[model samples]
Target: MKNTTDKQLLRRATAVHRDMLKQAEKFGVSASQYDVTKLLHTSESGKVKVLIDATERLAIAIAKRRRIIICEK
Candidate 1:
């Protein structure tokens, strides 16, 4: 169960994260560059694996200066 405050915090965190990502992109940094800046240096193994996969794609986009769209079916 989630409360209104919890939902608000989640929205705020997401907005901040998005801004950070945009700044990273503007500065020509890959999303992986901010991975080390995560609140904790650790995450669940499965989540970490997902992050690693997304980071790889972000690295490629940064290297090529092209956008990559990930799709979920």
Candidate 2:
């Protein structure tokens, strides 16, 4: 079995972190408000599914950015 360790990424020197946060906030609002509201009128299941998918997509976007930073370093 391989050992699991937490490798930390430093963020102090990253540019556009604030901008990314703003974009993430906007994504959260869109997922929580617009997407859910549009589907909620039809089915609860659809709302939940969309919410989960949006969360995953948001996480992936953030992860991609972090990977880019790590690679840069």
What is the Cα-based lDDT of residue 24 in candidate 1? Answer: 59
Candidate 2 lDDT by residue in tens digits, 16-65: 33344456565443323322334435652334445445545655776666
Over 1-73, each residue of candidate 1 has an lDDT whose tens digit, in order, gives: 1567655654554455556567557747666554533643454233334444445555555545534322221
After superposition, the stretches of candidate 1 with alpha carbons farther than 4 Å from their true spots are 32-73
- Candidate 2 has its poorest 10 consecutive residues by lDDT at 6-15
Tell me how candidate 1 scores on lDDT.
Answer: 0.50
List TM-scores for all candidates, in order.
Answer: 0.43, 0.41
Candidate 2 local lDDT, residue 19: 46
Q: Flag regions of model 2 displaced more than 4 Å.
A: 1-45
* Each prediction's whole-model lDDT (CA): 0.50, 0.43
Clashing pairs in 1: none
Compared to the true structure, candidate 2 yields what TM-score? 0.41
Clashing pairs in 2: none
